[model samples]
Target: MNGVSLQGLRVFLAVVESGSVSGAGRALGISQPAVSGHLHSLEKRFGVALLDRDRPIAPTRAGEKLAGHARRVLAATRELEEEMVRQRAPGGTLAVGASTTPAETIVPGAVARLAAECPEVSPRVRVGDTEDTLAALLRREVEVALVGQEPEDARLEARFVEEDRLTAVVRTGDGKLPEVTVEELSRASFVLRERGSATRRAVERTLRAAGVEPKIAAEIGSNAAVAGAVAAGAGVGVLPERALPRSPGVEPLRVKGLGFTRPLVLVTERGRRLSPAASAFIEVCLNRDGR
Candidate 1:
C-alpha cells in the first residue's frame, strides 16, 4: 500500500473497465506488458491477486474495494489541485486575439478590471478582422480569442459573453429623416467594412434577406474607418453600438428591416488546459458588463 501509486490505480481502473489486460493496454496507450506490470505491482503491494487473471478479466472483492478508494483519491486530488490553483494569485502574460468590435469594446474594459484585481497579469490583445482573429487563435498566436461571431469549428470552444447589436450611421445632417426603410437605404450609397469583417457580413446578410443589395461607396477596414468614411459623406455605415462613441459627425440612422445582432464570444482551444493567467483572463471577460 505504501508504493501504491495513482498511476497504478489508474492502470487498475483501466483494466477493470476494459475487462482484458491487452484491451486495457490499448485503451491506455501502453503495451500489454506494461499493463500487466502495473497490475502485478498493485497486487504485490496489497498481497492479493486483484484480478482473476483469465480471459475477459474480472476484479476480485479486494480489487472492488480498492478501486472505489482509488476513485475517491483521484477525485480528491483533482479537487485539491484546482482549489489551490484558484486561491493562489496568478501572474503572467495573457495573449488574446479579437476582431475589431470586441477588441475595442470588450478587451479594454475587461483587461482594465482584471488589472485592478490581478495586477500581475499583462493582457496583450491582437486586433484583426474576424477571419484573421480566429486564424491567430488557431495558430497559437493568442491564448484566447474574443470574436463577434461564434466559431463553428469543433476544435475550438466558444463562450458567449454578450449580445451586440448593429446600427446604421450616416453623416450628421445628411438627412433630416430620422428613419428610413431598407428599400430607401438600398438606394443610397453605403460605406461598408471590408469583406471578412463580421459586421459587414451581418449587414450584407440582412440586406440580402430584405431583397436588396447595398450600393457600395467605399469598403474600408475596421469600424473606425467605416465611420470616418461615412462622416466624410462617403455613405451610410453599419457599426456595432460600442463603436458609436468613437464615431464623430455621424448620427444613428434607423433602417427598418435592418436588424442584426450577434453574440460576442470568448474562444479557446478545446480540451487544452489553460495557464492560470489565461483562466483569469477568461473569467474577467465572461463577467464583463458589455456597457
Candidate 2:
C-alpha cells in the first residue's frame, strides 16, 4: 500500500504488548479481524515480519527495529494530541468512578501514568460497587469508569482490560481446614461483598451452579473490609486475588470446586466522544509505557 498507518502501528504494538490477536482486539475495542487486518497491512507495508506468530509472541528482529520507531512515533502523536486537547480545554478535574476491585488495584497506576502524561489535569476517583459505578457513568457524573463487571446498557460501551479471580481466604491463625466439596462449601458461611458487587455476583453464580446456595456470614462493602472481617475471624471471605491480604493475618485457600473469574473493563458512555483526559487515562490503563 502507501506508507505505514498509525492504526497499524497501534495494532502491532497492542499485539506485542498483549501477546495475542484477541488480546489486542480487546485492548483496542476492535474486532479480532480488525486487529489482524491492521497487522496484515503493517506487514505488507514493511514487506517483513513484525511479529513471531508463535506461543509467547514476540517481535522479529525487523519488528524489534520497527517497534522502537513505532513507540517513538506513537508517543509523539500522543503528545501532540494531548497538547491539542489542552488548547481546547486546558485544565479540569477528571472524575473517575470505579468499582471496588479496580479502584483498589488498577486505577491508581493508571492515574499515575495520566498525571505524568498531563500534569495539568487532576484525577479524582469515587469508589463504589459495580452497579454504582455504571450508574454514575450513565448519569454523566463521571467521565469514565473502571469496573469488574461488563455494562449491559445500549448507551454504554465497555472494553476488556483484564480478569480478576475470586479466591477464598481465611484468617491465618484460624488453622487450616481439609478440602471440602461444593456441598460442604455451601454449608460454610462466607464473608461476601455487598449485593451489588460484581464479585458477589460471580461468586454466587459459580456457587449456585455447583448446587451451593451460598450461606453468608456477613455482607461487606469493599474487598479490604471483607478481608479485614475474615482476618478478624468473621468468616471465609471470597475476594479478588489481587485484594487478598498480603499481611500475616490472612491467607488464601483452595476449595475443592469453587472458582470464578470476572472481566475487568473500562466503561464509558456510548456514541459520545471521550474527553481528552478520559482518553488519556484509558490509554494509560490499557497500554502502559512498559509492558
Candidate 3:
C-alpha cells in the first residue's frame, strides 16, 4: 500500500473490467507487456496474487477490495481537479454527445439555451446514433451524452430528459392508408434505421413481441435517409413522431398495438467529475421547458 502507484491501480481496474491483459492494454492505449508489468509491480508491492488469469480473467478477493478503494480514490481525485479548475477559471469548453433524434431536433436549441444561461461556457456537440453516442461518453470523447435509451452500464448515471414515440410513415400520394395494424406492418416492406439505432431496436422489439417479423426493404442509417426512402415509396419507415416534419410527400400513420415510446436520457460517467461548463449545460437541459 505504501509504494502502490495510482497508475498501477488504474491498470489493475482496467484489466479486471476488460477481463484480459490485452483488452486492458487496448482500452488504456498501452502495450500488453506494459499492462503485465504494471500488474506484476502491484502484486509485488502487495505480496499477494491480485488476479486469477483464467479464460476471462477475474480478480482475487484482495484485488476486489483494492479495486473498490481505487475507484473511490480516482473519483475523489477527479472531483478535486474539477473543483480546482472551476475555482481557477469559471469558463471552459463543454463537450456534448447526442443521438440522432435529439442531435437533429433538440441539441441545437439546448446548446443555445446553455449559451444564454452560462455565458462563460462554450458548448461543442457531437452527433451519432444511440450506440455511438454512448461509446463517445465511454471513450471520454464527450463529457455528457443525450441518448434515446437508458444506459445499462453501472458506471453511467442517466437522468430522464424527455420522451419520444415512434410512428409509421409512408409516401403521401401513393397510399390511402392512414393507419397500420401489426399484421399489416409485418406484411409491408419497410425502410428501417441501421441495427444499433434506438428507433429500429424499439420497432423490432415491438414487432417481435407481436409475433411479426418486418420485411426490411432498405437499411438506412440516418432519419433523413429513412424519411426520404419512405417518401420515395421504397417502403414504410418508423420515425419519432415529433421529428417527422410535415412533408407534402410523406404521411405519418399510427401503428395499432405498436406504441413504442422511448426516453431521452442525459448520461454521464457516474464516478467522473464534470467540468463547470458541463455542469451548467446539464442544469440548462434539466430546467428547459418543453424538453
Pairs of residues clashing in candidate 3: none
Top candidate on lDDT is 1
Highest TM-score scorer: 1
Task: Tell me the deviation in Å of residue 116 in model 2.
Answer: 1.1
Q: Estimate each model's TM-score.
A: 0.68, 0.68, 0.67
Clashes of each: 0, 0, 0
- Tens-place lDDT per residue, model 2, 171-200, is 885546656566656668899999999999
Decoy 1 TM-score against native:
0.68
Tell me the lDDT of candidate 1.
Answer: 0.86
Model 3 CA lDDT for position 248: 44
Rank list by lDDT? 1, 2, 3
**Candidate 3 at 5: error in angstroms?**
40
lDDT of 3: 0.85
Q: Cα miss at 108, model 1 (Å)?
A: 1.0
Position 3, candidate 1: lDDT: 74
lDDT (Cα, tens digit) per residue for candidate 3, span 1-291: 559788888899999999999999999999999999999999889899999999799999998998999999988989999888767553777789998888876787788887776777878888888888898899999999988888988889998888888877888865576666787777789899988788888888887888888898999998888988898989988888876774446777777766777888899999998887788778777777754
Order of candidate numbers by TM-score, starting with the best: 1, 2, 3
lDDT of 1 by residue, 1-291 (tens): 467788888899999989998888898899989998998898888898788877788889999998899899989989999887865766778888989998888888888988998998888889988888888888899989988888888889999899999998888998688779877877988989888888888888888988878889899988988888889988888889878898898989888656878888999999888888888888888877643
Q: What's the true lDDT of residue 33 in model 2?
A: 95
